[model samples]
Target: MRAVLLFAVFVALLAATAVFAYYGLAGPEEVALGVHGWTAMIIGVIFSILVGVGLMGLMFFSSRHGYDEPPQVRKDR
Candidate 1:
């Protein structure tokens, strides 16, 4: 189903992000992210996702409420 495919893709992308973050944070230079760094990262990611979802929800709500419809022309008698 479409939902299953979307879920699979989401999981794959999440896993890929985790792998990249792990490697990127602890690179060959032995750099590491501290607790504060991680906290900030998590908060930032959450905020970004929330903002994106909120915008998408608003867009859908607007469309459903007819705010996205074209203007109508009126004729006077």
Candidate 2:
């Protein structure tokens, strides 16, 4: 019952967000992106993608190299 209520609330919020986004984007004002704006946007997107890929690669590298394992205490030292 609680889960159902929580899901209903989540759905309602999503619907409300979609409606609000539609209204916000469909406003009366018209804006256009120039060549420079497009270039900057493309560069920003590429940079973000590169950063994400680099981080994921590092994560996989560390996991495979045993860096993700817990440190064991040296009892025989």
- Candidate 2 structure, TM-score to reference: 0.67
User: What does the lDDT come to for candidate 1?
Assistant: 0.93
Residue 16 displacement in candidate 1 (angstroms): 12
The reply for model 1, stretches above 4 Å from the true place, is: 1-26
Model 2 misplaced stretches (Cα beyond 4 Å):
71-77
Report clash pairs, candidate 1.
none
TM-score of each: 0.62, 0.67
Model 2, residue 9: distance off in Å is 1.1
Q: For candidate 2, list the clashing residue pairs, or say none.
A: none
Lowest-lDDT window of 10 residues in candidate 1?
A: 25-34
Question: Could you give candidate 2's per-residue lDDT for residues 18-69 as a string of tens digits?
Answer: 9998888676556656789889999999999999999999999999999999
